[model samples]
Target: MANQREELDGSLSVDDPILSLRNASVTFDEGNSFVLNDVSLDLGRGEILGIVGESGSGKSMLAEAMLDAIPDPGVLQGEIIYRPDSDTDIDILELNKNELRSMRWEQISMVFQGAMSSFNPTMKVGAHFRETIQAHDADVKAGMSRAREALADVYLDPERVLDSYPHELSGGMQQRALIALSIVLEPDILVMDEPTAALDLLMQRSILLLLEDLKEKYDLTMVFITHDLPLVAALADRMAIMYAFDLVEAGPTDEIIDHAAHPYTRALLNSTPNLDAPLEEMRPIAGQSPAPINVPSGCSYHPRCPLADEQCRSVDPHFHDTGEAHGTACFHWQQARDDIELNYKASVSANPNTPARGDD
Candidate 1:
């Protein structure tokens, strides 16, 4: 894997960001509530940027907003800038319908969540590939060749897969086919939402390996959205943690794993099961994630945060630089590392042997 953060000590961010989201917000009910709020991040070319959080954290919404694919009545606010190269800057939200049609699939393609449902059941896999390519006005004959090439790239035999319906393929095969289809157009950026969420552990690992291969083979930049932290940690060059529609923390994968600056980020890391660590060390986060419609005031994560105080209850926090290109949105980010460790030590000392409730 490439160490994009190696130069972080001297730079605040990537020298060239292929995609940028600036103060992006999405609302399904006008401005009454937001599914995504004030999200801002950058994706460097040829790098995988993983967006991870629990359900309802706006990871999918952020992905959809990037491609202007938000469903009916969902309004997107702020800028989604796509810089294909140094010479061009395209405001995604400003693009007309025709322009958008031309841009999608060719420049930015999405492998949506739920591979089983993402395809047309009645259509053969080849038909799906054919239609997608045809819609973009590419020659059907050439497109079929590209489709076959894509299938082969993902290790799927085009001969069997192209003729089969979505239901005909196994869960893992369906996912591999979906990935193949996403790349058939050879887009510069690929936005994949939970591509491996439905697969078994072994299959999931296989799919991730395939993705890593694809990333290198195609020189693809990817925005991977998922709820699994450990899974993303293995694949993403950098990780961004979102909470209640807000981006809580983002940094290089190594930096975030080694020294997470936010309480929520630490909680997530601790929550994951580690075979190398004692079972007692797996501490589940204390409370439920806040509901989107009823997001808490001030810091959205404060209600569940151990370090929250009066200020955290009344004033929202912005991203504070935590060095090495890491930025966390927490008023007590400076104190998080020690405080969380102290709390964990106290909890383990008190229980000693009892595993966390869900471990059973």
Candidate 2:
């Protein structure tokens, strides 16, 4: 949906978005390994798209592909299209080094995980802020002023952070400082890879709240990548679930969180510790995630799936439409959900204490 609100920086958004990944796949080791397979996703002009999955689930690779940061033996296939406006379009995969460099901070900026370690220790914090401005050709006074403003936005003391080195700041402060740096240039889209991964629960909540405020303050379209489902549900407009390197399901955040169709996604939601649910009934998924290098044939999730049958093992599943702009890569979503609902009913009947699965 096109945003009706005023744009951040008073800029205009194209009514139609061409910013999307269409069948984008990434492989390494001379194409011997596929880390991401046939992932197709489109970003709305001003919405947060959350990608969530377990560790080693290719979530990081997906972000790298968006930034065209893959190198050497890594090969990318299909298209990463960027259309800033209706008048122009660029295939991000085809850009050369110089061309890509110009677009990096100018159009898209990324906030890496463990933001504390991303800084250069040799330089004073202020110098790093100044250097970022220098790269964009802004003058010293303006950059410093903006740097202070950015820090203030993240609730950090600008003067202290500017003078101190990266090591002087607490982990959470450093992360907020990093986030400040990311948005200083006012990029259209901000891709955050596990931005709150290292923080404690309270800090995570605070940082996430800050992110939500910043998104509105800047009118930012964000790509929030993490394994934290509830976190994403709190911030993202829409979300996608990845499994075995494939984009398994995606929809509006509430829909995906409350009415999930994919088995893996259901398993994930069930596994989450819900305060409303009886603690004794909450269960984790049955098996460990598969090694990507040795991903199973047909459906990689089949081996661990409780509902897997001969058909699930032998035939690859294609995305089945569940709602408008929502789909799940599962052959039995309809039947599965029905059976699960029946089971939940039976359980509640038997115990009178079972909690219903009320999630995506």
Candidate 3:
């Protein structure tokens, strides 16, 4: 079935996609549950692409598949082609254990969520730092001196943080350490899964600024995974909105935020608080997200979509190019484009007093 779908769409060309997922599908059991369904995406160098969706939208799962970090008993069918800094492209899913091991920290790095769980309680923060750096460059000295420098790079004091354990450091400090560790190897691309989720507002801003600085200094391409639309708006050059394991909308960040094409994207933006405006101006999207295991037929967001009609309930929609660098997967993309203002006004009207949710 996957092959047939691929044949119909024609395989995504290798030259155009730096990292592409073409007709990708992942099923937990034999036709019992499909986590991902024929999803495709293209990422390029020097670009920061943000993937925004609710908890069960498979955002993290997609990240895992991209890195080939899925455990046994999981089946992934797709082409996750990685174009390294050396100008070599390899299908991550097809790579053997040794090959995968070789690429793990050297070519790509991931800053996963839950900083506490990610670190080893038994190991000192400095030791973990040295170990990670040594894994990539064994010749490089893995001494306290180097580890201290690394700690300082992430705004941590060498003397204090280097000797401290993961549990000893504050949540923000630990997250910064993880960020520091991820870049220690200087991987070409960094996949950050909610890098600021555990941080305070001030720390989140600081971390994002640090990321911007690192990107300029190291020439790194980043994939920032988060559900926060405002954060994406502020940081991402481009953005993709995921719904039920598939991309619902994608475009330049400015265009998507200002003129969202998909209902889900608009709903997401609607849910975000507008600090500059009065509380009465804020609005939240109505209804709950569909269950991934039993995603709604046709449009996955139709159940929660205000404009959903009979057609939306029966027929699935493919991504259609609405403008240059902007696309949406909705049958009413064109109509929605015309009616965006009206829809937004109506949404705001329904929930007149809901203030925009503030950043944590």
Candidate 4:
């Protein structure tokens, strides 16, 4: 396999998105269930696009769809176009097996959850790194020297990790090793699914910082998949919120965190724990997510949305842009916008002992 020669041209405006998903939908069980429903999003070059949602919200499924790793039984529809630094865009979903094989580690790479499982327990860490790099670039130097450098990039002691098996490394070390492996081929896009989920708070922060550094160093466009709103807020340039297999909101991270337009988005922001705030202040969204097989009609979120009304129960909301680079799928976005402050106030009122709204 050969790495595509399309390097970052640095010509496209920073405002121009490098990746786009248009009206994307994924279905399973012979179309009886829509795992992803008309979801669309964009990721600009060198920007981190964070995808946040609760468990069972189809966040991982969407990531798998992007990587074309959806199982055989599932069906995917819609376009995922990737533009490599202003060269012609390629439809990721349309690529055949051979094309996908070539593109996976060279053009785009994935850092799956459970980094330990991603590596072979029987193989030395160095061997795995060498194989991964060689798979994309056979001409790459296949020696201990290069492998050591790869380990060092993630702050791991090169010699110690090089000789250790996956089972021998600590959890944090394994995670960092996997991250190094993901970037070994230097793909233009790195799709990380909960890259720091398995680590402790300090380790998680460190990993995130490393990701930020690497992104700047290599100009990598990243897709950070997670349910943690605070982490997303800290690292991402933009964010897309998913619920019931559909994209409910997306926009610049700062805007999404401070001025979310979607009810679900607002709920997520409210649910996040504010360290400075009292325990009573952190109220997670109520009710379990609807099953994909039996999703609610009109809007999947209507059943759980506090702001849901007759219109929300009867009419499916379109993913409409709110004219500030923020888009939300809600029939009552305008009304919700007007009511956000009141809703937050009510939440705060319910827990008077909590810290002030802007305390953080």
Candidate No. with top lDDT: 1
| Candidate 2 lDDT by residue in tens digits, 98-206 | 7888777667888988866789998888888888888877677977887898889888889988999988888888888998998887778889999989977667767
lDDT of 3 by residue, 1-360 (tens): 122234222111222445777777777866566666777877767888888998778888888877888655668887888886446778998899888876876678899998898899999887887777665655455444555665676777877776889889888888888887777666788899998887766677677777877788767888999988776566787888887877788887777876788877876776666554556655676777666467878888888876889999887876666775787878887667566442233222122232222212
Ranking by lDDT: 1, 2, 4, 3
List candidate 3 segments past 4 Å from native: 1-17, 85-87, 134-137, 140-148, 338-360
Q: What is the lDDT of residue 356 in candidate 1?
A: 17
lDDT of 1 by residue, 13-119 (tens): 57788988777888876677788887777789899988989988999999999899898888998888899997789999999999999999999999998899999
Q: 188 in model 3: Cα distance from truth in Å?
A: 0.5
Candidate 3: give the clashing pairs: 273-356
- Residue 44, candidate 3: C-alpha displacement in angstroms: 0.8
All models: lDDT?
Answer: 0.82, 0.76, 0.73, 0.75
lDDT of 4 by residue, 1-360 (tens): 011112221211135778776666778889888888766666788888889999889888888877788887989887888888687889998889889988887788899989888999889987887777666655546544656666777788887887889888878888888888877776899999998788776677677777877898767989999988776677887788888887778777767766788888877767877554566776678888988888887777888887898888877776666756777778888777777542333222122231111100
Query: How high a TM-score does candidate 4 get?
Result: 0.87
Q: Give the TM-score of each candidate.
A: 0.90, 0.88, 0.87, 0.87
Question: What's the CA error at residue 306 for candidate 2, in Å?
Answer: 1.0
What TM value does model 1 have? 0.90
RMSD to true structure for each model, in Å: 7.2, 8.2, 5.2, 7.6
Candidate 3 global lDDT: 0.73
Top model by TM-score, which number?
1
